[model samples]
Target chain A: MKNNIISSIRLTIVMLILFSGAYTLIVWASSQLTTSHGNGDVIYFKGKKFYSNLGQKFTNDRYFNSRPSAVEYNAASSAGSNKGPSNPAYLASVQARIDTFIAHNPKIKKSEIPSDLVTASGSGLDPHISVTSALIQINRISKVRGISENALTTLISKQTEKPMAGLFGPERIHVLKLNIELDKMQ
Target chain B: MNTEIIGVILSFLVVVILAKPMGRYMGKIFSDEKTNLDFLFDPLDKLIYKLGNIDFKKEMNWKQHIVVMLTINLVWFVLAMLVLTNMGNLALNPDGNPSMSLDLALNTAISFIANTNLQHYSGETGISYLGQLVLMLFQFISAGCGIAMAVIVVNAMKEKVAHTLGNFYYLFVRSCTRILLPFSILVAILLVLNGSPMTFEGKDTITTLQDESVQVSRGPAAAFIAIKHLGTNGGGFFGANSSHPLENPNYFTNTLEIITQMLIPLAFIFAIGYMLKRKNLAWMIFGVMTVGFLLLALPTIWNEMNGNPLIEKMGINQHGNMEGKEVRFGAAASAYWSIATTVISTGSVNAMHDSFMPLSGLFQMLGMMVNAFYGGCGVGFLNFYIYIILTVFISGLMVGRTPEFLGKKIEAKEMQIAMGVTLLHPLLILTGTAFASYAYTQNPIELSAWLNNPSFHGFSEMLYEFTSSSANNGSGFEGLGDNTPFWNIASGIVMLLARFIPIIGPVAIAGSLASKKYIPESAGTLKTDTITFGLMIFIVIVIVAALSFFPALSLGPIAEYLSM
Candidate 1:
């Protein structure tokens, strides 16, 4: 029994060096070959570096809203709220979001508000929103920015990513990219 | 068929092609036979033995082996708890993540130690880099322990009568050094090259295209992600798991991840065949498992591709159920991975399970419930072996013959242990679910926070958590608010009991069988290595899992599906 414990500890230490140190070094070296170079992919925007892969917040009325973030869009601590539907607290939060959305966009009906707009995404860093989510927000954005709804609709279509192979995932728009494009339209 | 179906077929083909060689190599390594990698590992193995004062030649009986296994795991659990609870003070925490709450720490420790990897907390924010490494250590050891247990069982089965199973320390070390290490390093390199982050630096603050600044988390993710799949330890480096663009960068990496996760579990099945020199028996067993896997997978893929009926009714020209899936893998690939991960007990996901169609959720849950269908490394075969025994016992009764397996009589003691282990799976899951249900009903205000989805789907979330814990398959519905003390402690207990007891029971049964006198084959002897026996085992597995879990299934996924 004593020998087993000793051996187990020794084995763990040996494997830890191999796995944690040596293997990590090997992977680090290999990661140098990728575009990110072991750091995440960064896109330069207006003298600022941005991680293109991560979800970003867009709270301004003129800009299209990003998905609700459980972690307040803190990419450093990515996670879901992990709140089930039955939980009154979670439901209350969703209901609150719904009310807020309705308050902001009186042009859209309450039932027409997409779930993606109110519910938090699993990552809390989901950069994309369903086409419906983007479309529902178009009226508010157009009204706020003084842009024609037709042009905004066209821009939404341009930003919409079709399902992979035309039959894979859902049609969605990158919220940050769309908002950025909205800014560029000025 | 579309490219999606082709990808699935190709993935299975690769696993089948690689299984024999990998299995044979593993068999040789565990048997201490001269192998191709001996040149590299031999000196290291000896040095380890010398430094640890372990006598490689000394063997232990089943009782001793299990004690050692449990003790080593306990040691690891303690170490993990200490590290996790003190993570805020630990280095490599560039994010300065605080230490986990006591219950969360305890749950996380047990989850990883048991090779379950059920995370009540997110990876990037909840744990420091050092903590991730500690979890990684557990991943390798826990997986190695499971493989060692399986190897010991195989050794017992090979021998007609033996006092000692082979040395547990020797097998455990070799499992890590030979099988897991080399495979993980290779996969890590591939993952890194394919664009996973592998750095010690802190989170990088970045301004998005919208001119909003956000801190993007990065870490030594590639190393952890590789073994997480290869070892069937499915805890994610990021909260979004493989769904995150960084964790699984592209389709190539996605395919690699799926294949890597399935490789060891499938290879272990073949290893059993090679070690026992019963190729036919191995094929039979493999065939049964594959059939069961396909039965679960095909429907899930079809259902997910069909998209949610609720969404379809809204005139949304739906392109499959892409709600929680990554676009890179698409519905077919994500569905394929979902089923594969669950079936093999590799709980890593490229898609969010919470967003899957109700029927798809049922199939995934069933995969874990009937965990014998090519389950986790070494443990999968052990679980299946229990079913094999049960089948033999029932067949013997039906035919009015004495039940014997590999010349050892299946007596009351063996039956009791086998039944105990077999029944314990659903027992823990159902009981846990029942308790949670009762609590939810009795104290809705307090316990209601535990569920994410209300009504039928919410019940499914709770059921899936217990099932995943009890099966040691760590994937979750994700919508469940499980970070609280109630879930953390309860699931922790379930994970520990579910993992060790099943392993101990099988090892005990194998040890007892090994000590019995050998009986020569005769005309009246039941042939276990035949297709007929395989079919019987298959039927027994299905019936047992159905009998136990069918009612729960009806209330959860089935009811949700019907409503949809």
Candidate 2:
């Protein structure tokens, strides 16, 4: 038993190095071949870097608003507003968001507002919103940026990502990338 | 079909196609048979054994195996504590995240070591890169430990019983090298190539297109995430877990993660058939588990797809329960993930359970409450075996015959252990929640922040924590503000007992069964592998889980649902 205990400790140490050290090193080496070079995909817009996959706050009138973030789009810590559906406070907050959305985009009706527009994502930094979510904000952004609605619509269509193999998952657009193109059009 | 429904079906079909070969391969590893990739693993394994000074040929009785497993797990616990608490000074602190507090460290260590991975602290700002690696180590070995113990139980079930089961070290090493490591590498490479980060760098400060500066946290996450799923250790590298875009980059990775997490638990079912040469029994168990799984999963998918009625009443075209869900996966896929992760004990969340529709939360909780549906890797089968034993005994009483399983008589001692193991699950979950409720009621002001949602939903948060802990299933409602000393220490104790007791109970039963004189099956003996017996096991599981947890369920999610 004593010998076994010693061996057990030794094995634990050896296995840790193999899994956590050597194994991670191999994966790291392989990451060097990827486009992001293992640091995560970065999109440099006007000399300012942004993680292409991570969400950013875009609440300015000139940019299409990203979804509401519980952490205010804090990339360092990801989380959700873990509010239950029946919680009165939570429901009221969603109502307030609905009111706020209607206030911002006066032409849009409350029924036209997709729930994703007002909801906080499970990851506070969700990069994409449904394609419908992107399109609804066009009226507000077009008025603010002085760009024609047709131009903004064309840009959103170009930035939209189809579901995998055109059948699985959801049709969505990267909010950061779409807004980046929106800014470049100016 | 809706794309959401199609995605859900595709994920399950992929797992079905993959389980057979993986199960066969795992069978070879466990039975000490040679395989095609063994040339690569054999030398690597030999070096491990030599360096660790392990006697690869030495066999151990069941008690020895338990003791050895615990001893090594202790080493891991200590290592985890040291690193987590001191990570502020550790070398890999590129983000300079401070070390964990003592209680949080204790909870984190126990959570990972037990393979429960109930995170009391968020991953990004909570621990350093070194701490992530240490927890990742536990992710690999703890799962290897579970698979090894399960193999021990399987060995004890052999018809021609041997005095000694295989060496714990040999089984442990082989489980890692032959089973976990190669598979993890495959997943890690896929994740890395598809844009999940895999670097030892600090967080990057990124200025948004809106000109807001936010620090984007990245690390050796792809490797961490790969084993996190493959080992069924669902401790995510980020607070939002797989919901984080980097942790699960896209729909393809989402499908891959769910499939990877569900694969091994199902594969182990097939492995049992291959090892025991009881393909009928394996199929029976598979049938029972799949039925239980779909019963939970299908409703959850339906619930999420129906959209939250409360939100719908707010004069909006609700896109299901998107409050705590991702757009890329949509409602059906996210709902599918919640049940799959819980049922398999992976606990990795692609969608936050707290924000799920009330009934959906109930289904998720029920999945954990009946943790044996497919369960975590090896331990899932162990939990299922307890139900099988109880079913055999109960049915024997009905037929007025001796309860014999696989030619071994199920005596009072084995029955006692089985009953005890079955009772422990509910006792731990209920008592822990009851205590927390008492404490909260006593000092509502002091513990006001313990719950994120009020009234019935708050009660569900507390109930879900203990349930997740006791089941060793780790996924939580997350709305529970659970980082307090009360939560950390309470759930820590629950996770420790929950993990070892179930394992010890089954191994002990299997060991005892192996030593008894074999009684040949006769017409009077019950056939455990038949569909009728599978029905009996399912009935027993439902009755046991329902009886124990129904009241708690009513108070928590069910009440919340009705109120809504």
Candidate 3:
């Protein structure tokens, strides 16, 4: 039993080392991920802090709106409240987001807001907003960049991933892609 | 689009078409129950025992046999690990696929040794030619080892004392030589005939249209691929995976691969039941497993069959949603491959699963939930024995009788072993997936930020993959660039542990039972016979799987469902 303990202990240590080593090697091999698409100036933001710089940095014309994100009272938190459309909290949150979105994009109609625009992602702090949301303000962004909303939306369509291998899920637009297209338009 | 569709069909056929003959041949080799093949190999067994001066015929009880097994199998494991670690130097010639890193080597070494072939690297570019033969060869051996252990345990449970607990050296040797080697040779040749390449050549260098010096991947792919499938250990030699024309090729080879993969495992079931003189039990086991496999798998095919909704709405119909799928075989073929390999612990992917629709993707994850239900080669059937024992135990408790499986009593100790075997890997998977999914939430990949809201869902799927991989069921539908160490090592270790630790439980129980006196198969023995026992066994398997993985499933697949 003592020998068994010793052998297993030695084995455990060896395994741990192997685990870390392999992981490190995998990490190293996957360094290609690090060298990909360069980072842009959309700083990670939280709660009301994000509202202060709304149009100052994220201009309606220059920056296409990504998904609306509230830090949800800023606790370093990130998860969808998991509330459904029927849930009051869900309704309240969606209403609040819609109000903010409408106020920000004055040129857009309240009816034009895509549901994904205001709805919190499963991860509430989703940095990306839906393409429809971006589309809601595409014309404004077009005015700033001197590109038509059609061209921008076309680019967004190209940038978007076809729903996870062609079928088995719903299609939605990506926020990061639209904003990047906005940057390229500039 | 055509490329993706054919690739899917080609791979799907590879699973179903190849599973039978190889399975039938393996069934005859492993069984103590007679076939002409066993008779021919009988002298070979005697030869090894005589030459080694060890009396294999010496009457030994179960405990002694298990101890011998522990030594032999464990020694093999260690030696295989050492060889894998040192394979870089051992290669006859260096191929484009370099030697695996230490973490990869260790994980891979143990994975093949345990007969759970979860790969972190692509066959063509990531692993060397030597690694394939040395590391991959071990999988075939370990699979045989699994059979040998089962044979020993089954014999130990027999009523009267036998002169032999099937000769380990003979069983292992004959298993590889008779069943695995011949089948692999025939299949490899057939694969080459079907256009799957089989050579020991290095990579072919090609000057691209742009005049770039790109080194195209080449190796003794078909040779190892033949064994890889026959052994039911599905690690692709290249990035194109089984979808690679050289590995799967046309529909003929595709069917051959599917048949071979299923044949080895299915035939073993026949072999085990026949050897135990319980052919009925064998069919029952197969029937129960097949029913569950179809239930989960059928939907996977149906759900993906019609094409992507987004594609329809957007009017992009040049091809069916062949996003991650191979066009050569199309939706039907890839969908079947997705279901079969996941259910069987074969992880070769023909389609990029990261792009599979939500439920189809979820079904793929669910296949791993019942992974032990129809796990890989040696591990899969032995796991069924534990499940069988457990079903008997639960039924006996309810029916007011001692739990006796095949007339051997299963008490508290056996229950402990069964529960451990059932639960240990799920814990690894659940916790690992939970941890990884949470990590994914923290770190999302920005694919031009095209990875919108569903990226987290992809992360959830990745968690499922790592869980599936580490747990020794190597099916991937969600696109995870697992060629990285984070995935490889984590998955590799999980694969190794999930594959081997469960065997320890079965072996220990077998040894313990071998020491006991066998009570006769009386009435009210809670018959492991009949469809009723099969149902009970199925229920126990389902319940344990549901309870262990359901919460995590709710977190990953369910979450993906709601998001989608």
Candidate 4:
């Protein structure tokens, strides 16, 4: 038993050094070759920095809004609302988001507000919104910014990321990138 | 078909196509047959064996295997505790995360070591990069340990009778070096190139396009996530797990994560066939697991894709239940992932299970409750072996003949151990939930903190926590405030017992069987590889899981479903 314990301890140490040390170091070294340099994909636009993959809150009406976040797009601590589908309080919050979306875009009907606009994503920091989610917010952004609705729509189409292989999953727009492009529009 | 459905089908297809070759590769590794990759891994494994003072060729009996497994696990637990509790003082404190409380540390350590990765705390804010690295280490070794123990059982199951099984250290080390490490490095590189972070740089305080400054938590997440899925140790580098955008960037990485997580559990099923030279037997087992998986998976996909009815009544026209799910992966893929992870005991989530339709939650819980349909790495087969034993014994009694498996007579001792192992799952889960429910009722006002949702759904939350822990599946309802002393300690104990007992029971049974005189098959003998026997095993699994968990299911997800 004593001999096994000693071997066990020795094995654990050796494994720790191999996996926790050598394995991770290999990954870290390989990551240095990527464009992000392992710090995450950062975009520099107009002297401001943003993580391209992480969602950010856009309270201003001039920019296309992101999905409702449980933590208000807090990247430091991500979470979902974790509310059950039938919870009254959660339903009420979704209703509240719908009402707020309708109020912001008076021209848009309540039925037109996509559910993604109201629901909080699992990560809270979801960077992309559904293509429809982005489309519904266009009226508000266009009305606020005085950019022609056509121009704004064109800009969104430009920022749209096609579904993987153009055949699987949803076609979505990266909200951060869309908003950045919106900023660039004359 | 819609792209969402296509995505789901694509993920499964990829897994099916890849699992066979990977299984054969694993077969060669465990049998010490030369593979092309051996050139790379042999030297590393030799160094590990040499440094550990292990005799790679020295065989051990089942008791010795268990002892060494437990001893090494003990060492890991202690090391994990030290690193987790003192995270603030750890070398890679880029985020300046505080050290864990003793109870939380205890739970975290056991959760990872048991291959149950059930997190009572969120990843980004709870532990440091050093801490994540240590936990990642446990992820690889714990899974390696599981595969090795399973291989020992495979060794015992061989046609020839043997006193000593293959050496545990050799199998364990080879599993890590040959199987897990190579795949992890490959997947980690894929993740890094595809936008998941792999760095020691802490939180990058980036200014958003809107001018709000927020701390974006980054780490060596690509490395962590690679092994996280590859090992079926679904503990995330971030609290949001694969659901986080950076942790699982886009649809490509999401698909990769799903594929990698399901890969080993599926491959292990095939490897058993290769090792035992019972390809038919493996195929039969695969059929049963696939049928069981589809029964749970199809409904979850339908539930999520149908969208929540209550929300529809509120004037929303969403394609599916998007609540607490990502837009890129959509409902079908997320629902597929939830069931896949649960059935395999991966327990990683691409979507928040708490926000799933109540019936989907039930299926997810059922996946773990059954706990044998393509379960975690090596242990999945071990769980299924218990079911196989029960089936053999019960069917034997019906036929008025002694039960036999692989020509070894099934005796009372093995049956007792199998029954004990089978019952321990429900016993641990129910007793733990019942105790928590009782405590919650006693001080409803004070203990209200335990649940985020109200009434029946809240009951489901507590029930899910214990179920996930007891199953060693590790995915939780998340709404449960489980970091409290009551949860941390209760579920920690559950995880420990649930993990070791099931493993020990199967190994012991295999050991006893290996030592017995071989009984050649006869006209009256029941063939485990036959369709009839497969059906019997499936029925036994359903009956056991259903009978044990039906009452608990009714109280939690079923009640929630009826009310909705």
Any idea what lDDT model 3 has? 0.57
TM-score of chain A of 4: 0.96
| lDDT, candidate 4, A1-186, per-residue tens | 898889999999999999999999999999998777988888889988888888899767877888889999999899999999999999999999888888888888878777888899999988888888888777888778888889878887888888789889888888888887787885
- Arrange candidates by lDDT, highest first: which order? 2, 4, 1, 3
Query: Which docking band does candidate 3 fall into?
Result: incorrect
For model 2, how does the per-residue alpha-carbon lDDT over B1-564 read when each residue is reduced to its tens digit? 788889899999999789988999999889988899988999999999999999889889899999988888888889899999999997999988999999999999999999998998888899999999989999999999999999999998888656788899999899998899999999999999778999888988876777677888889999999999999989999999999999998999999999999999999999999999999999999999999999999999999988999888888887788999988889999999999998988999999999998889888888888899989979999999999999999999999989989988899999999999999999999999999999999999988999998999999999999999998889999989899999999999999999999999999999999888888778888999999999999999999999999999999889988887
Task: For each candidate, give the TM-score of chain B.
Answer: 0.99, 0.99, 0.86, 0.99
Q: In angstroms, give how far residue B370 of model 3 lies from its true place.
A: 1.3
Which residue pairs of candidate 4 clash?
Answer: none
Model 1: per-residue Cα lDDT over B18-132, one tens digit each: 9888988987887668997789999887877777677778889999898888877877888899999999997889988999999999999999998999999987779999999
Off by over 4 Å in 4: none
Q: Supply the TM-score for candidate 4.
A: 0.99
DockQ of 2: 0.86
Clash pairs of candidate 2? none
What is the TM-score of candidate 3? 0.68
lDDT of 3 by residue, A1-186 (tens): 343234333432332232223222332233223321111012222111121101111324356654443323121122223222122343455566667766666787665654445433322223333345556776776776788868877887776544334632223344444454455555
lDDT of 4 by residue, B161-236 (tens): 8889999999999999999999999999999998999888877787777788898888889999999898888998
Q: Alpha-carbon error at B548 in model 2, in Å? A: 0.2
Q: What is the TM-score of each predicted model, taking all chains together?
A: 0.88, 0.99, 0.68, 0.99
List of chain A TM-scores, every candidate: 0.87, 0.96, 0.61, 0.96
